[model samples]
Target: MIHEKFTKDSIISLSNLTVIKEIDDYTIGDEQKNIFFRVPREAVYVIEEAEGHNTIEEIQNSILQNKKIEIDVLDFMNTLNNLGVINNISLNEGHRNNFIKNLGKLLFNKTTVIFYIINILLTIILLISFPNKLTPNYQDTFVLSSIGLSLLLFFFVSWFLVFVHEGAHYLAVSATGKKMNFQLSIRWFWVVIEANMNTLWSISREKRYIPFLAGFFIDILIINVSFILILIINDIFVISLLKMVALIQFYKIIWQFIIFLRTDFYYVLLNYFGVSTLTKGSISYLLRKISSKYSLFFDQLSIREQIICKRYSWLYVISLFAICYLFLFFSIPTVFHTLKTTLNILSAFAYNTFEFWDSFIVIALIFFEFILWIIAAYKRFKRGD
Candidate 1:
């Protein structure tokens, strides 16, 4: 009985899997485990033949007869089994709900697409019509009744917008029949809410674009609505608040385009090139070029990957320099000036005064943001991410 079970004639039990064809390879994997592999066309044929009805020997015979190529049937079966792709499993629905799924689909329909385009065009027209609002002013951030209250309001509203951004990514992933996991994380010095859409690997490359760009799309929508409200609202306070909201949304959209920060556009570029480790690989490639000590790391990459890394290294280097320069000159100076001004205000005003409270609030907000960044960074380090 044991010998018979081990024979090539034994039926193969393939797990539920998703297979997508890329430009040069096929992406096949078990979505339940969030594991995927890029294989050649021939490997896809082998996988297709692994239905329960076919025995291992029969699958090999069929492939050989059709493609005139030989493959080790038992070895392939073992490989799949090791990868947990030869087991029975179902899609994990514990994190998903029907309402979110339906809403996700609704948000990406043809009607919504038309509105998205219209919103973008209208926003451009408004910006052109009112060129004064094109530049963002820091004064807009303090448009509320009191400076302290305005600062608090901006903090809460900024976080609310961040939630909406991540929510858009979640909805887009749901639309593609996948669920997303979100985490409060830090990117460089900024505290960010990130959505992990790794399950998207199971879908086609083209379908992944919307989920990646969804945050930007929603930001644009918010900016468009804010601009419209600013035009219609006669009250100065309301107009100022709307302009501030629009300015923040505009900043979010621009931030997404900073590819070096591994923003949405960065992922879009990775998907377009069908390269998974372009950023890491590019950095390794540059390091290897700088010294022989890094040769071992660069040599670990395949020849094709090496070429890709070499090609992308220049862009990475340039972006790195640009970011370093910006941080040293713009960001550092802005921080010092803000801190100096807040300290002066605090010293000039009595503790009972609104001016003193405003400076206190600014310091408290800065400290709060710093604490969040520290926690996020610690969590990231613990996870080895």
Candidate 2:
């Protein structure tokens, strides 16, 4: 809630504000509310001067003297107050300092980089030296005699690794003195685990990269460790299971590179370009151009961003076509084959037999994944995302 009135004589103080400069405007706000606004650079300077030491009148006069612009200090303070930026609430640091002190050294140091490099080199050398043993095979996923049991085990292990991957991201953001939200979400037709750290916008671009790429780093580590274990172990079952895990991790890494899907790497690219809403802006611009029925979202963008979106809109259109191609050629056929195989097994095998259970479990898992996707989609729609 905001105070009802303010006088020019009143001293002004701002909440903990994050002001990041972009191509044309500055993104400024309090991260506690996860709310931000794009203000001009002059407004940012005014915000910086509102540190509770000066009266609104003095601050306005100072800005007039320094920047030769006469701003309504009272109106500006009222606007900031309405936006929850000029508040008396003290944010809880809550072990953030400790987290930065500890995890910062453990995860973001030179020693860790060297260790990661060594692991990568060792993994490469082992793969080259024993290509046959290191290469992933589909048969490795069916290590158990019962196909149903093998698939269930694989599914559980894959989900556990997903948890670890998201955890890495959570920890990285925590190290930067921020919190991240974890959710079960859907990406197109696939159910995915996600970590939402929108507050990262309040942080510097360089610090933001680690959190975005943390999952990829963890996946690489898992792959390397799995390969190392495969070389050290002679048991066929152990080797096969390790190979399956490594394969899944490798697939995840590749999936992140699918920029059209808005993967982690996509966020990295957005940060690198210092653009906040490139994907959404580009898609909306393309839509508005095709049909005026759409909202004037594209017209609302800054000139610099409008140009960027116009250039990227063509690529966005191509990616949409590519998605349609993949659905027609790959996704539909794969689902069709799985259902066909399951139906045949169900018809041929007795109800109590392992073959019947295998088919039943596969169908059940597919249904479960579909239900999850539905739930995620509903949540997204409700939020107007």
Candidate 3:
């Protein structure tokens, strides 16, 4: 005889993730860290047959009556137990629901949406009214009168703006009456606030779109508000600072369109087309094409799925081109310019002067950022992700 512990509240359902091929996609879920464990269809049958009290042989006998299945009962039990999804402590739904409701109350509704629309329109109009302030003068705005202080200032300001951006996403998710989790982590050498996307799956697709897009909307708001503030502010230092922040916000807006990065727009595109794994599928197709080998990448899909992939592939290629162009045209030039300016400043100032120390700080920051980039890249490579 054998005994097993499995949660009565455990869910076995189709996965929300989009896949390349049409296969039976199922996931097991419990209240464990909002994570789901995906398994084969046969595993679902095994779980259903287990029923906690039944011995492994008894469960096997029941399943075998209908079909032959080969699953190591011990291994299966261990996996679920380790995942804390089977026979785990029950979640306090009442407390969770109450928290979600409280958060939901803070979300923007129709009336608030209307107000936001009006503000957004007004902001655009204001931006169009001020053409000179749109072009960024990084030196005056970011460097201030002191070069040494610039990197530290830039880091803090950028962090604040990102906090606001992520906060917008949090509010958007809350508005949809979904639970959200946030983590501070590094991505591509930059520290970023990561919102748990798994929580979004419980909500409507349309509702999910806004949460993903909320950051970009906030970025636009930042830019527009900076422009407005610049008009009223008399201080050159303040104006220059705001202008630089505005330019950074503007660059963030452009960053959203790089769909190859699985950016906010990437999610938008996926939701709009009602497809999953579009980017991965497109890349595979492109790779096959490059090898002068036609594969059945599209033929395996349903006609509708085929069309989505076919259309999305071109956009994926376009995103790749945009990334290359941005790196070569924008990134390289900025790095070169910054390095040259820093070197000049360092040369002009004596080692004992504040200016030299300032230049040294900027140089140190540059090296630190580069090191972070290398660490991130190496980790990703080792993980084969």
TM-score, one value per model? 0.80, 0.80, 0.73
User: In model 3, which runs have C-alpha deviations exceeding 4 angstroms?
Assistant: 1-28, 36-84, 88-90, 94-104, 117-124, 137-143, 183-191, 292-294, 317-330, 347-349, 374-385
Greater-TM-score candidate between 1 and 3: 1
lDDT tens string, model 2, 1-385? 5776789998877747888876667778777777777788878878888888899899999999998998888888888877766666546555566755577447854457567677767767877898898865445666677666776787899899999898888778887777768776778777887788787888777778877877877888899989989889999888889988986786676577557788887888788766677887877876785766444777887888888877866766565565665556445664665577678888886888778988888878878878989998887778666
In candidate 1, which residue pairs get closer than 3 Å at backbone N, Cα or C atoms, i.e. clash? none
**How many Å off is the CA of 66 in candidate 1?**
4.9
Task: List candidate 1 segments past 4 Å from native.
Answer: 1-12, 52-96, 281-337
**Candidate 3 has which clashing residue pairs, if any?**
7-87, 18-276, 148-358
Model 3 over residues 1-385: C-alpha lDDT tens digits? 1235533333322122211211333445552356544466777777667554566666656677776766666566656666655542334433346554555445455555565566678767876776666654444335566655765787778878888887788777766655676664455545456666665654445566677877777787678788888899999888878877976786677667677766788877876775555765666566765553334664455677666777887886677676666566556665676678789977786888777887898888877777766766665567454
Task: Score candidate 1 by lDDT.
Answer: 0.77
Using alpha carbons, what is the TM-score of model 1?
A: 0.80
**Candidate 2: which stretches are off by over 4 Å?**
1-12, 21-24, 53-61, 72-83, 97-101, 114-140, 284-337
lDDT of model number 3: 0.64
